[model samples]
Target chain A: MSYHSVVMVKQVPDTANISGQVMKPDGTVNRSKLPTVFNPEDKVALELALQLRDRYGGTVRVVTMGPLKASDLLRDCLYMGADEAFLISDRRFAGADTLATSYVLAAALRKLQPFDIVFAGRQAIDGDTAQVGPQTAEKLGLPQITYAEGILDAAGPKIRIRRKIDQGFEVLEGTLPLLVTVVKDAAAPRPCRAKRVMAFKNARTLLELEKMAEANSLLYVDQLKEEYVSKGLFIETMTADDLDVDLARCGLAGSPTKVHKIDSVILGANEHETIPANKEGMYALIDKLMDDHIFG
Target chain B: MNEKKQQVWVFVEQRDGQPADVSLELLSKGRKLAENLRGELKAVLIGHDVGDLAKELFRYGASEVLLADHPSLRHYNTLPYSRIVSELVDQHQPRIVLFGASFVGRDLAPRVASHTQSGLTADCTDLQIADVTYLRKDYAELLLQIRPAFGGNIIATIICPDSPVQMATVREGVMEKIPLAEPVAGHIAPIPYTPEDCDELVRIIERHREENKVDLKAAPIIVSGGYGMGNFQNFQILYDLAHLIGGEVAGTRAAVDAGFIDHNRQVGQTGVTVRPKLYIACGISGAIQHRAGMQDANKIIAINSDPDAPIFGICHYRIVGDVMEVIPMLIDAYKHKLK
Candidate 1:
C-alpha cells in the first residue's frame, strides 16, 4: 500500500541575513523593505517528506497558508519533486498568530484527507515561535514529534526517528498519523531538477489564470484553465470561502494575543577607539589593549 | 465557570534527575511575577525519583511544587509529558505558564497551549506582569511577553487578552536565578499519573547528551566571526586569532547559517548568550540578535570591512578594514607585543 504525507511550509523574510530588515524611527520594523525567501528549515522538512516518499513508495504533497503569491513557493516545491501542491490564502487570514494559523492549517488538512504523516519546519524565521506544527497536531488530535533529525525506519505503520534536544539527541518510535517538525540539520535538501523546473515554472493558481485571461482578451479564464489542466499545470488553490472555517478563528480577529509595543535595540553610548589598519597603528592598538590588560 | 487564579507555573524540566538551569531561572523570575500578581509560584516537577527536587525548587522560590512521578515519565517523551501538563492546566487553571526555550520545552509548551486553547509567545527575552488596557478592555495583571520579532529588527511586547492562561518560553540566561535568603518550606501537591494507552504510542529508544568541550560562555576572550568571513576555509584566520589569545571562537547566526561555523558556537538571541571579557569580532556585521547576546562583554573590539557595520556601534574598538587583512595583522602583532 502506498502512503501519503503532507508537508507544511511558509514564505518568510530572509531574517538570517543581517541586512534583511530595517528598523523605523517609531520602533517598528519596515518589513516591506526586506526580501522574502522560503524558510530554510521548511525546505528541509519538504526534503524529508520527499525522501520518505522515495523510499516508502508514496507521495509528498506540500501546503502553505500564505499570500496568493506563495504559489511561487509551491512551484518551488514542485521543482524539488513534490507530487502535488496546495496554496491556502485569504485576506481574512491576515494578522494571524500561531494559534489562528494552526486552526486554518488543521482545517485545510481536514479538507485534504487520507494522509498518514504530516511534516513541518521547527519554526519560521519571521516569528520564530515554532508553535504552528504542534498546535496543528493538537487541533487535529494527532500525536507529534518535534526537532526530528532523521527517520530510521518508515516501511510500516510504525516509524522510528532520531530527534534533537538540548545538547543531545534521542531515538524515538511512534505510530502513523503523526506530525514531525524538522530542523535544518535533518537533511540537505536536493536542488531543483532542471527538467521539473522548466515543466512547473508556468504553474499558476485560478486567480493568477484569471488575471492572465484578463490581460489577454482573446483568452478566456475557463479555456486557459482547461488547457493548463490538460498540461498538468493547474495549481489547486483554496481561499477562506472554500474551507469549513469559523471566520472568528481564521484571522487577526480570532487571535487572542496583541502586540503592545515595539522597540529598536538600545545601546549605551560607547567611547570607541578607532584604529588604522596599517602596521604601525595595529601595533599601537595592540599595545594599548595590552596596557589595559584586555589582552594577556 | 472559571475565575482567574493568582497562580503562576514554571515547568521544572529535568533529565535523568538533574533539573535544567533555565527551569531554576524561570522559578526565580516566577517568584517575583507571582508576588506582583499576589499569587503563589508553583513549579510543576515531573519525573521519576525526583521527589527531593522539590526542596531545590523551593530554594529557588517555588511556593509549591506539583509532583507527577511515574516510571514511564522518567524520560521526556513529548506525548506523555504534554498530556499530563495539558490535563493539569485544564483541571486547575493557571494565570501564567512559563517554560524555557529549550528543545523539550519548545516541543511540549505549544502542544499544551494548543490543547488547552491558551495563547503562547516564544523566545521571550523579558517577562513581566502589568495592568494592560487593550482594545478598550482593561486586563489586570497581564503577562507581558517581550521578545524580538521580524529577525530581531524589532522588539515587541505581546499580551494574551482572551486566553485564560498566558504562556511564554523564555530564552535561557535572560533571567537571574536568585535563591531566596530564607528558603520557603517546600509544599508538595501530588498529581496522579493514570497510565493511558495513547501515552504509550511514542517511546524513547536511545538518548545521548554530550558534554561541551568548548565552553564559550566561560571564555575570557572570544574571537567571533560573521557572514563577512566569506567562506568555511577563511574561518582558519579566526581560529588562529582565538588560539593566539587563548580564547574561544564563536559566530553570529549569519555565520552559522552560512556554514562558516558550528551552531553550537553561535552567539545571539536564539543561541547561547556570552559575555566574554574581550570580544574580538572579525568580519561580523552585528544584528540586534547578536548584540543581545554579547552586549554585556566587558570590552569589545570589532574588525569589519564595512565602516557602517552595526557591530561597530557597541564595540569599544573599531577597525574598519578587511578581517582577512586585519585579523592576521592582529595575530602577528599580539605575538610580538604581548609576548
Candidate 2:
C-alpha cells in the first residue's frame, strides 16, 4: 500500500547572517537586506518525507507559503526529489504570524485532500516558534507528533514514531492522516542530485513565468507556462482566492500577535580578570573560582 | 467574564503524579502577573489523581487550582489536554495564560490557542503587563511577551492585542519559582473532563528514559565543551571533570553537530536554555547562539586558546590557554585539594 505525504516548508531569511541593518528602526525586519535560504530544519522534514515515500512507494508533495521568490525554494525541493511542489503565494497573505500562516496552510491542505501524512520542521529559524505544525494539525483536526526524531515504522494506516521529550523519548503509535514536526537532527538531508538539479533547473511558478514574460518582450506568459507545464517543470501556484481562505484569517488582519518593540542587544563583559597561561595562574584562577563558589 | 473578576491561568504540568519544576515556576510568575492585573492566579492541572498536587500549587502562590483528573491524562497526550484547556479557557475567559516552554507545553499551547483563536508567544524569556497601543487602538494590561530573536542578537516584545486571552510559553530556568512556604488556604475547582470518541488517536507504547543524567536546567554547574574540544575522545575529559565537580557535561551545537555529543547534552539557542549557578565553557568560541542559552548563568568562566573568542566577552573569568591543557590541570588540582 502506498502513502501520500505533504511536507510544509518555508524560505526564511538566514538569521545567522543577520546584522545591524537587518532590523529596521520601525521594529520590522528588513527582508531585502538578509539573504533568504531554505530553512535548515524544513529540509530535514522534507528529507524525512522523501525517506517515507522511498520506502512506502508513494509521492511527496512539498508546500510553502511565501512571496513569489520562494519559487526558488520550490525548485530546490524538486531538485532534492520532491514529486510535486506547490507555491502558495499572494500579497494578501503577507505579514502573517504563525497563527495566520497556519490557517492559510490548513486551508491549502484541505484543498489538497486525501493525504495520509503531513510533515513540518519543528521550528523556523527566523521566528523560532514551534507553533505552526501543531496549530495546523489542530485546524485540520489531525493528530500531531512534535519533536519527532525518527519513524520506526509506517505500514498501511498505522505509523510508529520516536519522539523526543525533555530527558528521554517515547515511542508513539498513531493512525494515518497524522502530522509530525521533525527535528533538525532527525535525519541528514540528502543533497540535490546532479540529474535532478539539471532536470528541474528551469522549473518556474506561474508568477515567475509572468515575470519572465514581462521581462522578455517576445515571450508570451501563457505559452511559456504551457511549455513548462508540459515539461513537468511548472510549479503549481495558489492564491488566497484559489484556496478559498477567509480574507479575515489570511494575513496581518488575522494575526493576534503584534510586535511592540525591537531592541538590538550587544552583550559584553566590561571587565574580566585574565589569568596567565601558566601553572601558577591556573592555581590562582581555580582559587578565585572556588572563592566565588563556582567550583569546589 | 467581568473585568474585575478576571483570572490569570498557568498550565500546571506534571509527570509521575509530581508537579514539574517549570509548573511551579510558572505559578510563581503567574501570581505576580495576577496581582498586577488585580485578578486571581489559577493553576490548571490535567492528569490522573493529581488532586493532591493542588496544595503544592497553592504553596507556590496559586490562589486556586483547576484540576481535570483522568486515567487517559496520566500520560501527556496532546488532543485531550488541549481540548480540556481550550474548553476551560472558553468557559472562563482568563485574561492571561502562561505555560512552561517544555515539550508538553509547546505542543499543547498552540493547539489550544488555535482552537480558541487566541494568540500565543513561544519560549518567552520575560513576561510583563503594560498598556500597548497598536494601529491607533490602545489595549491596557496587555501581556508583554519578550523573547530573543535573530539568534539572541535582538529582543522582540510581542503583544496580543486582539485575542481576549493572551498566552505565553516561558522558557524554563528563565524565571525563578517562589520558595515552598507554609501552605495557604486555596480553592480547588474540579473540571470534569471526558474524552470524546475520536480524541485518542495517538497512544504511547513505550518510554525509554536516559539513566543517571543531570538535567541541565536544574544542574547547578555545567561543564560544557564546544567545537574547540577537537574530537569525540576529548569529551571524556569533560565527563571526568564534571564527575569530579559533581556537575553535568553539556556541549555547544557545534559539538553536537560534530557527533561528539548527543542533542540532549547540547546547550544553545537551538538546544536547551540553561541557567546554572556556574557555567564553564571549554574551547567554546561563544557564538551569540550559544551565549543566548547560557549567558544567564550566575558565573561564567571560559577556556579558549584564542584570546579573541567571543565567549570571553561575556564570561566573568578568562583563561587564555588550551582547554585540553587547562582542564587536566584543574582536575588534578581539584583532586589534590580534595585529598
Candidate 3:
C-alpha cells in the first residue's frame, strides 16, 4: 500500500523575543509587537513528510489548527508541494495547552482519513513542552517513533528508521501507519519551488476570503473561493460544523489549566563553600547543598 | 486514596558490551528515590553477555537487575531497546523511569515514554519527590521534575499530570554519582530475549567516528569564548587555553554565529545546555540564550573589559580585565607553575 502522510504544523508568535510590552493588560500577546513565524521544528517535520512522499510515491497533506493568521503557513505548505492543506480555525482552538491542542489536532486528523504516517516536530519552540506529538499518537492509537534522525530503509509494510539517542543512534523497523517526530537535524527542508509558489500565491482561507469580499466589491466571496478551490489553491477551511467535535471539549471551555502568573526570576548563589576531594569534604558539600534547599 | 507505590526502573545503557557511566549515576539516584518511597529499584540491562553489570548496579543501589542479553542486542538499536523497555515497563509498572540525559537518553526516553503512554520531561537539571505520600493516591500526579526555563531566568518545576510514571532525562553532571568504596554483593535475574525482540532492518554501511569534539556535556572545565574575542582568529586563543586546562572550548550563541565553532559547541537556549565545574566566559557579552546554557556551571568566571557586561551578573568572580590580557596572564601563570 502506498503511504499517505499528514503533517501537523503550527504558526506561533515568536516567544524568544517577548518583551514586557508584548503582553498587554488583557493577558493576550500583542501580535503587532512581536513577529510570527512558522514554528522551526514543524517546518523540519513538513520536510521529513515531503521526503517520505518523494521516496515512496504518496501524498503529503499539511494541516494547521490555528487562527486566521495561520493561513500564511498553510499557503507556504502548498507552495512546498503538499498535496492537500487544511486550516482548522475557530474561536475554540485559542489558548490551548498541549493536552487541549492535541485534542483539536487529533479531531482534525480523524476528519482527514486514510494515512499510513503522521509526522510532527519534536516540540514547538514557543512552549517547548514536546507533549503534543506523543499525545496525538496516543489518541490515534498508533506506534510512535520520536527523535528520528534518518529514514534508513523502507520496504513493503515495514519502514526502517535510524533514531538518535543520547550517546549514539539506533535503527528501528516498524509497521506502517506510524507516527514519527522529526528533529532539526533529521533533514534540511527544501525551498519552495517557484512555480508552485506563484500558483498558490492567491490561496485564501474562508476567513481571508470574507475579509477580501468586505474590502472589495468586484468579486463575491463565494466566487473567489470557488475559483481557488477549482485550482486546488484554496485552503479547506473547517470550523466546528466540519468535524464531530465536542463543543465543550473543543476550546477554552475544555482547557482546565490556566496560567496564574509569569515572572522572570534571577538566581544568585547565596553562600559559597569549597570542599576538598575527601569523604568528609564531600559530606560537608552535601550538607551545604541540602541546607540551601538545593538538594534533599 | 493513597497513591499506589510504583517500582523504579533504571536503564542500564551499555556500549560495546560495557555499561555506561550514566547508568551508574541513574542507579545512585534511583536507589535514593526508591528507598524514600519504599519501592524496588530495578535495573534493565540489555546487551550481549553483559550479565556481570548486574552486580555493579546493585553496588550502586539497584535492588534487582533485569538483564536482557542477546546476540542482536550487542549493538544498541532503538527498535529493540525501546521495545524491550516499553515491554518491561508494561509488564512491571515503574512509577518513575530515570535515564542519564546523555545523547542516548535524549533519544530513547521520548520513544519509550510515548509507547508506554507516559509523560517525559527532557534535559532536567534537578529531580525531587514533592509530597510522595499524597501523590501515591493520584495516578496522574507527576513526580516534580525541575529544570531551568526561559534561558536560566527561572527554574520551572514540571510534572506529567496523567502518566503513571513521571520521567525526566537529566544532564550528566547535574546529579552526583554515588561512588561505593567496595562493590556490594547482589544477584542478577536474567530477562529472556528472542529473535523477534530484534526488529531493526537498517543495514549499516559505514560507522566512521568523527574526531572527538570536546563533549561540553561531559567536560568539567569548559572555556567558552564569546563575541568579545573580536575576530574568528581569537577563538584559537580559547582553544589554546582549553588545551592547557585539559578541557573543551565552548562558544556562546554570538561566537557560534561568528563561525567560531560548530553547532554542537553552541551554548544557549537553542543550543546545548552544559553544567561544567568551571566555565570561563571569554570576551562575550552574556545574552540570555548564552547564559542559559552555561549558568548551571558550578563556578563561573567572566573575563570581560566592560564591568557592566551581563556575564558579570551571573559570574561568581568578575574579572574586569580584558580577555586578551587576562587569558595570557592565566596561561603564563599556569605555564610558570608547570615549569
Candidate 4:
C-alpha cells in the first residue's frame, strides 16, 4: 500500500512572548526582533503524515505558502524524510488570514498533482483559530476529520481514526482523499535523522541563490540552484501565476476580514464584598455580585 | 400573531448523577442572554431520570427546562446524546446553544454542529450580545464570542455570520453561577429520548472515578507552583501552603514538564484555566500562556526568587523571596495563628 500525503506547514512569529518592544509605532510586530519557527503542532502533523508514508511505501511531500524565508520550515521538513517539498513564495502572498490561507494552500496543493490524504495540525499555535483545516476541506470539497488524536488503521480507501473529544475519544472511519487535523497529543515528532539532515543541509530555494548572487559578484545563481536540486535541497518554488490563483483572492486583496484594533487589556479584579457562609451574608454577597454584573 | 422568539438553550452536562459546574455557569449566562432578547431560558437535560435536577437548573435562572431523559442516556454515549441534541435542535431551533467546555461538550457540540450544518466555537472565554437596529426595533444580530488568541496575548472576537443559531462552548467557571432568588418560576418539559431511536456504536468497558481528585477549576483558593520550584520535592511546600490556606494545589506547564505533577494539574494555555478567589504563584515566572489561564483569578500573589519575574506583572502583591523558604514561613505563621 503506497500512501501519498501532503502536510501544510507555516512559519509564525512566537506570539507567546510579548514584551513592550513586540509592537512598533505602526502596531506591527518587529519581525526581526521575534523568533520564528515551524508551528509546533504542524510539525507534529508532518511527523504523522511522514510516519504514514514510512509505514506503507509512499512519498511524503510538504507544501508551504509564505515569504521566501518561509523555506526554512520546508527544508526542516525535507530533513525529516519528506520525499519532496514546494514553497509558494511571492510578494502577492502576504497578509493572508485563515480564509485566504486555505485558498492559497488548496491552490498550491492542486499543483502538486494528487494525494491520498492531507494532514494539518488542528490549528496553528500562533492563530489558535482551528479554522484552516476545515476551511481547506471546504475549499477542496473533502470530508474532514478534525481534532484527530490517532489514526487507528488504514486499509485502502477506508481509514479508522480516534478523534479526541472534550470527554474522551470517538472512533470513526472515513474514506480516502480526506483532510485530517491532528492535535498535539496525536504523536511525538521524530527528530531529523543525522544522515538526512546533513544530506539536505545545503538545500536552497531559487530566491536564496539570487540573494547570494546579489551579495557576492563571484557566485553564480544557476550553478548553486543546480547543485541544490541534485541534493534535493531546492524547494520547488511556485507563484500566484503558477497556481493559477485569482489575483483578487490570493492575498490581502482577496481577504475581506479586517483587524479593527489590537489592544492589550489588563484584566483587573472588581470590588468584592466578602461575607460569611450564613444565609443573610450570602444574600448580601449575591446582591453585590448582581449589581456589579459579575452574577445575575 | 406574535413573532416566534428564539429561546436560549443550555446543555445540562452530568455524569454519574454529578452535574458539572459549567452547566450552572452556562445557565447563569443563558438567563442574561434570554432576558436581553426577551426570550425564555431553557435547559436540554439528557440523562437517566435527571428530572430531580430540574429544580437545580431553575435555581440558576432557567425559565423552562427540556429534559431528554432516558435509560440509554444514563452514561454519556455520544451517539444518543448527539442524536437527541440534533433532533431537538431541528425541531425547536434555539438562538444560542451553550455547553461546558469539558470533554463531553467538546465531542458532542462538533458532531451536532456538523450534523446540523451549524457554526460552533469551542472554549470561548467571553460572550456578549451585539445589538443592531433594524425595522424600527433594536435586534440582536450577533453573539460576539471572544476567546484568547495568540496564546493569551490578544482576544479574537468570532462571529458565525451565516448560521441561524449561534453556539459557543463556555470554559468552566468563566461565568459565575447565579443564586436562586426566592425559588424561580419555571416548568419542566420532559422530551422522551429513547435508545430504540438511537444508534449505539460504542461499548463501555468499566468507568472508574479518578482517586486523586484535585478539581482545580472549582477550587476557590489555589497555590500554584512552577519550574522555579527546582525539583519535585520542593513542590511539597506549595502543597503545604495550599493545604494550610484550605486551597487546592496547582502548577504551571513548567512544573508539569518537570514531572512534578500530572498533565491534568497543569495550568496554562495547553492546560486548565482557573479563576480562583486567591491564587498564590510559588516560584513561577509567568509566561503569556500561563498568565492567560490564571489571570482571571481574583487576587494573585507572587513568590519568586527574581523580582523581575513576569508573574509580578499581573500579581496583586509580590513577595521577592524564594518559594522554598517563603512558603514554609507562611505555613508556620498560619499554623501558629490556628493554634
Pick by lDDT: 1 or 3, better one: 1
lDDT of 4 by residue, B163-282 (tens): 667777876667778767765788898887656522433334334454337688889888899989999998887777777667888898778866888777878755677988878888
Which regions of candidate 1 are displaced past 4 Å?
A: A18-29, A216-219, A222-227, A266-268, A278-296, B1-5
Q: How well does candidate 3 reproduce the true complex, by DockQ?
A: 0.16
Model 3 alpha-carbon miss at residue A163, Å: 5.3
What is candidate 3's lDDT per residue for B225-295, written digit by digit as tens?
98789988877998898888677888886677567876668776546678877788888777655776788
lDDT (tens digit, per residue) of candidate 1 on A10-82: 9987766534235566546677776789998999999999998888788999999898889999999999999
Candidate 3 per-residue lDDT, tens place, A16-124, comes to 5566687566544566777777887889889988887888788999999888888999988888889889999888777765556677788889988888888988877
TM-score of each: 0.94, 0.93, 0.76, 0.73
How well is each residue in B1-339 modelled by candidate 2, as lDDT tens digits? 554777999998887787878788888888889889888889999899877887778887777889888888898999889989999999998999998888899999999999999999988877999988888888888999988776566788999888899999987666787855676588888889877866768989998755527588889999999989999999789999998988899999789978889877888765677888989999998876688789889988899999887898898888999888899888877776664
- Model 4 pairs whose backbones collide: A166-B103, A167-B103, A167-B104, A203-A233
DockQ of every candidate: 0.69, 0.60, 0.16, 0.12
Candidate 2: TM-score of chain A is 0.91
Q: Write the per-residue lDDT of candidate 2 for residues A202-258, one digit (tens) a residue.
A: 999987899889999999999998899899998999998799788999798899988
Candidate number with the higher DockQ (3 or 4): 3
> Taking the tens digit of each residue's C-alpha lDDT, what string does model 1 give over B132-194?
999788988899999877777678899998889999998777677788888898798888998
Better structure of 1 and 2 per TM-score? 1
- CA shift of A237, model 1, Å: 2.0
Comparing 1 and 3 on DockQ, the stronger one: 1
How many pairs of residues in model 4 come into backbone collision?
4
